[model samples]
Target: MALDFYTNPMSRGQIVRWMLEESGLPYEEKIVAYGPEMKGENYRQINPMGKVPAIVHEGRIVTECAAICVYLAEMAQEADLAPHPDERADYYRWIFFAAGPVEAAVTTRAMGFSPQPDQEVMAGFGNYDLTMSVLEGALSGRDYLCGARFTAADVYVGSQVDWGLTFGTIPSRPAFDTYAARLRDRPAYKRAKARDQALIEAQNQAQGPQN
Candidate 1:
């Protein structure tokens, strides 16, 4: 019944924070600073990747933003974030799509690494352009990833689109714009974002003005 969330306010932990709020579950937040704090042996034992945004639920550890979202959704069944029986197909398909192609494409672009045309087949996302096009089509006429109803899939996928637009990694397509707007309107989204933003501001203040 107890959950511990390890994260850094400025990292992808924001995505899991939103999912926590959406799941309506109470969790202990452990702030793991970057660099040595994150990679220290103690923390490394919790997450082999030495990354933030990990959760220990009833002693079971879950890492990775997308994995954590789906895990929480299943735990908080009453919140209805998990996919319904009828939505199963689209649910798993798109959630993993976002976790896979969308996630890879955005990161590769951000890192300034583009897969050459011939390397497309070797790349999980092919190329950023192709990846975005596929995502755009999925969201064109839907309010959420699984359709009109919102589910856990939207949290992961929406976070990607939301983050993409904010950082200029994902193009500002009309479909992306509409989808992001819908997800952002959720009360949980607001709460999670505000909490992370406050933490960021506090950290910045502690560091004082930087050149």
Candidate 2:
């Protein structure tokens, strides 16, 4: 069966779309619109969470942006987007780091919530400053998350950096600016951006302008 990608261009699905392009594999995209279309029974059957950015590959279903990126990279082993078993420590570390701490920190800050010092222990990200500081240190002098080679880890983490900077959810530091610039230079990233942009424009036109 061809890979089935469920997504909406306005959502986090763009991250997975970029990864699919990087994998160089063919996939059939099912554009699940926002609101009731995504929350309906058909889509919910594929993802109980009623989320976009799920993938069906060979009868198996995978969800979450980071998970989908990692899954596709492993499926395309020859593409060299994933590290060998021996070098996967950094791969797993940074991938989950982006998915976990980075995501939590950005969302929390964007929503105007800050954890109190006493509540830090109860928070997974501790605090936004600490989370961003650690990430900045990790990418400061590195070309990619796993050093010289750009692996699937970079795709997931790089998307976080790119989006974070673009929306001001994360601070604009020198390391982040440099890293996001490198990610944008990728052909896969560019292709995904163009495709998603077209989709967004069409969706907006269909809805017509606001009053």
TM-score of decoy 2: 0.98
lDDT of each: 0.92, 0.91
Score every model by TM-score.
Answer: 0.98, 0.98
Name model 1 segments beyond 4 Å from true: none
- Residue-level lDDT of model 1, residues 67-124, one tens digit each, is 8999999999999999888898988999999989888888888888889989989997
Query: Between which residue pairs do clashes occur in model 1?
Result: none
What's the lDDT for candidate 1?
0.92
Q: What residue runs in model 2 are displaced by over 4 Å at the alpha carbon?
A: none
Clashes of 1: 0
For model 1, where is the 10-residue window of minimal lDDT?
Answer: 101-110
